[model samples]
Target chain A: MKRLGYLLGKDMRLLKRTPTIVILLALYPALVAVLVGLAVGRPPTKPRVAIVNQVPENKRDIRIGGKKFDLDKLTKALYENVDGYNVKDPAAALEEVKSGDAVAAVIIPEDIVEQLESSSSQGTIEAIFDSTDPTRKAYVENTIKGLLVDTNNELTNRFTDVSLDYINIIVNGGEITFGGETRNIEGLANGADLIKDVLPYVPAQQRKDLQEFAALSEGAKQGANFAKSLLRRVGQPIKLQNKPVGTNSSLSSLAVAVAVAVSAMFVALLLGAGMLAYEQEDQMLTRLLRGLAPRSTIVIEKTLLAGICALIVGTVMVLAFGAFVDIRWERAFLWWPAIIVASISFGAAGVMVGAASGDVRAASLASFMIGLPLTAAALVPKGAVSDGLYSVLQVINSIFPFKPSLDFLRAGLSPGFDALWPGIHLAILILAYCLIASFAIKRRVA
Target chain B: MPVLEGRDLVKRYDERAALDHVSFVVEAGESVAIAGPNGAGKTTLLSMLAGVTTPDSGSVELPGGKLGWVPQKAAVYQKLTVRENLELFARLEKVDDVFGSATRMMDRIELAHRASDRAEDLSGGMRQRLSIGMGLIADPAVLLLDEPSAALDPLQRERLWELLGSLADSGIGIVFSTHSAGEVEGHADRVIILDGGKLLYDGAPADIGPGAHFELAFINFLRARRAHVNVGGDAE
Candidate 1:
């Protein structure tokens, strides 16, 4: 191993002479951290809007097609707890929608509340929703839709309960002559278990249509009490909270920044590889091997050197942006080993490149081939692609040293799957790097 | 006892051979000078002896721990100061009082004043002195140099010869290659001559001193042999 030790000692001595690595890994981060602390913005969030009520002033004695009805209850539901509901010009409500001042414009027409007291499908209402953003638009539509559906469904259920229809049928009647005989009659009960089973799978809005179909099927055997019980049991529509995981703005900004930072580390890896390639081109590698050192020592020293370099760079990046500016330091010193593996992986990658081609440009090209795919894996989230795709990426990244350990970085940023997984990532890196180093050393160079 | 020996050594390059079944040996206190035409495998043989490059098919047996090799052009770290280069070799070789030894050797070779200069900044002769100083730090049993005097001026060459004479006096085996047959005759204990990767003569410098005339005759004999006519009407 004298030869390897000699090579490593030479490399370290060379590194000390140049000191380019110190500037890049250490100084750059310190500068970036200072800039980020000074310039980045910080604040909280708030949401609001304006509501307009279009109910007529004479709605207490309102007219709808020469018919008058009371509208007090409807107006109260529309105006209660709302930020600001004004009974003013309809044009001003339209202006609110145009100027983006309001999320939506609600108009409660005259006699609309009166029509709600009876069973008829001929009533129309207008609630103009702004179409600027689909997310806000969907939010307004769903909220308004929920209220209207509940009110209409309540009124319909009340009407249907009073108008309950049924039929009586005699299954069998037999006349018997005896000392004392009584007329015998039997009643038939409807089978509705099938409808109940199928009803859950259909959409909530389509449940009313199914109700009519079931009613028709039971005309000859309708039972009022059982149907009433079914309605009471399945009456409440399922509610989904639909609220997104966290504050949308922060989540997105965090995601984008993490992706960029991860990709930037690849660039750092490329620079390290380029340094190795330079040594190869200069014939220093051969010179080192010819010295008094073993092959294993040479490989270990190189790996250690690269690992240290990567740790320094990764820590700097975290200190600059990951910790103070954007995301806090989630994994302490975990990334140190992880980055070391990544560095070795890249260094070995470059050795293969430089050794094969005996040139720096070819080495860079080889590194780029590796960097591009890992960059893609890091940029996208776990579920951003398909399950099959994510599985394939996991396999690819398992063999890759840098790509897998990034999961630890991801975990540090957003707590996830398990910490044990980073260990897997680290183990894979070490195993893969050792395998490559052994092959390179054991394999014939010429 | 002989300090370095190689038997039936052969080294090849690509499909061609640079050394063809060459063999030689060195005694413990002898200073041997190797002379060869360009491409005659002198450097290759020196490298094999120094354990820098292994031959295609050969064996080197040295009853010792280490050998010092001074390749052509010094091949030392140019960025390092003279003291640092010596210190590094001293550290690796486990030479006690390395700085003291380095300074002593540098003084012996007249490199004391330039000890602080970067190796690259030193003159060719000064660099050669620095390299020899490094080679001697471990008190190597065998020292192999390739073209040690090729780039030095006449005065530097004489100075190196004096140093070599002193080293040989101290019972170190020195094997160096050179193109100057006269220099070999004056400085070397034994002169070995190579022609087309073959060793033609190996003996005392005085013996080869007379063979300078034989070298001319040999060249003529070889030319005439190539120019001979055969019964088949083609030049042999």
Candidate 2:
């Protein structure tokens, strides 16, 4: 144990003397965290969309169910919803999208109003998007679709209001003109009732026919009232409301920050591997091995040194992310242990790599190659990959420290995070990696 | 009593033997020089004796099991000051009086004035001295160095030899590997020559050949060894 302290002290002095390494160890992870925070924390930028209106000015204003509607109103709503600019024709709008000047093009057909007026036809508004960039294309498509849905709801509401007014005229007994003679609907119903009252003096057969006529008059009035009520609800029947439970909306950003911070283990791995390789290059390992210091003590000291360096980097990254995003500073206690264990795990893995590699350059390249892909695989969402690939990633995440460390950090930062599995997972990984590193070091010395 | 002994040390890398059935012994208060061409197993032999490496089929006997090793290059921590390097090694070697041992080693290596200077700031000779001091801090019975003065100038080499000679005179057996015949002739009390994983000669440097020039004797010995190997191969 005393020897281990001496070795660690020597490494610390070495690290203190090398200013560039110390700076890189702290800055690399912090930069990654800051960049990721800015990406997910900031509001999304609006996509540029081209609007092509093919309708003539004269036919722009059309009547639907005796209510005047303007096609310009729909286009105006679209313009308000997106970063829109007018184009002369569909070809020009498509050209804008294809040339990358616009993310999408919305083409309003010349006969859109005619299609809306005709009950048998529906209007077709063409949308063109640059398919090469699927993510931007999907965003633009959804934005335009949302705008169209709102406009469709408004048009449906206006038509329903007009239809309801006509139903009201029938149900409330309004006056109507037939063959140049004006007659009240209530007066006709009363005349039928008068006939029914006279039925008691007539024969039984005549009474039956009068009863049927009275029934028909009441049924027509009741049906019109029901139709008016149903038409009023036709505009919108379902409303969606979101009720978030337990977790804050900003917690996702914190989770992202944690993931980015945990990735700093790569830096730790490089430091650990590079330190060992440097010892070998400088012939310090040979000297230490020749002394009374045991091989295991050397390995442990190097692993701890790497872990300590990584822990500093991880802490800095978290703080850097806190500058850009909402971080739960109160929950830092929960993540500190996780970061420490994870850094040690990566450090041990780095030692193993350094032991197996031939030199400093080989060790550095190996650390990057192993750390990058494993880190990415551990953090990639299940939905981002195929089921087979995701299953493979799940195995990797289960065994490696990256995903577990990220989960542990996220749990620390958010509310209602349960399950103590990640802690155990990281513990097991640290032990396994440390043992492997020791074995590799022993083999190298042999 | 012998401070270090090796019996039939044989180390093979696949089909090539780095050291084949080599054997040697170093007595106390003796300075022995191991002279060899490149790939002649000097480092391999030294490593085995220091316990840094294991031979395929040999046993190294050190009475106290305390040995010191200095690699071909000066292996001091460049970032650490001379005193710090000494103290660190002393602590690692489990010396009871760490501070006192370091101070004594600094003075013994004639680097006491530069105790606070980082090893990297020191000249090649000073760094080598520090490295040797680190090896000596444990008070080992035998010290093994692989070309300790390989990077030193004439003055530095002379100073290094003087320090090593004094250490040997103080009853610590010193064994060092070198390619310089001058070092073997002037500094070594005994010499061992190796070529092609075989021990060519082991005796006093003056008694190796009839000639006065040790370099000519060494070249001629190598030629004779090659001729003997060729004749043996023809016989096989």
Candidate 3:
């Protein structure tokens, strides 16, 4: 054990003296974590859109039942939600987008009002956006589509009100006979106010019927108001309430997992190939063997160094994630086990490679060849792939240490998260991998 | 008993014999130099004797005590300071008070002034000295070196011999393999010549005569041995 300490200390001193490689290795994962953290699930900035209104100038005046309406005024009201710069010609609007003056161009259809009035068919609004800023272009396109949606909603509401008004006019203009007394139903909307005043003068049966009628009228009026209000809000139903379990978003958690996995791999490989394999490459191990130290001592020292390096890199990645991403560390207990398990597992793997290959370059190359695919399997969004591919990926993911670690992190970082059973199972899985690797390494060294 | 001995040692690589039935013995306080041309099994024999690798069909007996091996290539960790390297080796050898031992070893190797310098920053002579110091850290009864002064200048080689002489006087057995017989002729008490994985000569260096170039002597010895083998094959 004392000899092992000396070996580890020697390696540490060597690493300290070679500050360039040490610093580079330390910063690699941290920088990657920050970059990935900042990028995940963040919405694109709003884009500037150039608008071209093509409805004829003379057709701007819209008349309905002798009431004059300005089409431009209505369009302008809906366009207020968009960051639109009005241009004279649709071609000119597209030219502005091409010139990088705007991210997108939206041209209102030429016969929009005519289509709406004649056939009730909505006219399409043509939009063009720069491909260079795809995210911003998509944002602008969605915004414009939303504006058109609002215009259609407003038109529908106006038609509904007009229909209601006509119904009200006809009902008021006619009369209904109740108990041989003809009463106008147009005032039914205010019947509750009228009934209280007339209750004393009416007979019991008549009074009861009037009270029922008044209640029915009041309910209908309320129901109509409710329908109108509901229609106004109908476009945006099912509001998404973002309830994050931890400080990190789902994307941020994924980023953390990937960063941790890669960093753990780097640390392990570096220790295995760079520090442990150096002895063999330089024939120092043979010397040590001839000396008092046994092969088991070499194994112990290599494992210890790899483990320490893995822990350092993993911790740096996690801390960088926490700093760049707003991850709630209060529930960190849930996720920390994955990091620990992954670090040890990778470290053990590194030692195995280092011991077996006895060449630093070979060990490093093998580590990367194995690690890259494992990381991808662990971190790639399972939903993005086909069901069949995802199933296959799940199987592949199960084969590597990264998958269980990533799974534990994802579940642990989710909202309303409980039941650490899955995490425990995954921890055991990683532990099994680490144990197997350690045994292999020990055997190889011996 | 001799401090170290090997009997009928055989080593093969890919069906080709590196060392064939090679045998030697070294007593305490003696220095033996294995002289050979390229591919003459000098390193393979040393490796087997050092117990770094096993021979195919024979045995090597090391002293019932510590042993040290220095490969042809200097194997000190370049990133570590001279003292740090010594300290690590000392600890591995279970030396108590590793720091004190390391400092003493550094002073003994005449590298005390550069104890803090990284091994890579040292000159060839200094690096070789440190390598030897690492080998001495185990306090081994016998030490094996493969071309220890291969990369050193003449002055450095002389200094190394002087150091080895003092160590020999202190009762340590040393076995070294070198391509240059000229360098080992006066320093080594016994000189063993090998050719084609077989020992051609084993005797004191003075037996070759005072004025003979050791290289020419070695070459002549190999040619005569090969001729004798060829003549015996024809008689058979």
What are the clashing pairs of model 3? A247-A327, A247-A328, A248-A327
Which residue runs does candidate 1 get wrong by more than 4 Å? A1-13, A19-21, A28-291, A322-333, A347-399, A418-446, B10-20, B33-44, B55-57, B149-166, B177-236
Residue-wise lDDT of candidate 2 within A1-446, one digit each (tens)? 87788678888888899999878776677667767877877876767889888898889986765568888885677887778899999889989988989888988888889888887988789988876777876877788788788778878887887777656656565665545686666543455567677878989877777788777767876777778788877887776799877655364445564554455577768877888888887878777776466667877788899888888777777777777777778877877776787788778778877877747899999988888888779768769989999999998877767777777766766756642777788788877776776677666665
Put down candidate 3 lDDT per residue, A220-264, tens digits, no spaces.
767766665665555555679887554454667766766677777
Give the lowest summed-lDDT range of ten residues in model 2 chain B. Answer: B227-236
TM-score of chain A of each: 0.49, 0.79, 0.66
The sequence of per-residue lDDT tens digits that candidate 1 reaches over residues A113-191 is 5555434644456677786788988887875665466445544454444333211222122332233564443333333
Share of reference contacts found in each model:
0.07, 0.81, 0.77
C-alpha displacement of A429 in model 2, angstroms? Answer: 1.8
Q: Candidate 1 at residue A161, lDDT?
A: 45
For all predicted structures, in order, the TM-scores are 0.57, 0.79, 0.74
In terms of DockQ, which candidate is stronger, 1 or 2?
2
Best by DockQ: 2
The per-model lDDT (C-alpha) reads 0.61, 0.80, 0.73
Model 1: DockQ against the native? 0.11
Candidate 2 chain A weakest lDDT stretch, 10 residues: A249-258
lDDT accuracy of residue A286 in candidate 2: 71
Provide DockQ values for all models, in the order shown. 0.11, 0.55, 0.39
Candidate 3 similarity to native, TM-score: 0.74
Q: Model 3: DockQ against the native?
A: 0.39
lDDT of the structure predicted as candidate 2: 0.80
Error of 1 at A192 (Å): 34
Candidates, ranked, TM-score: 2, 3, 1
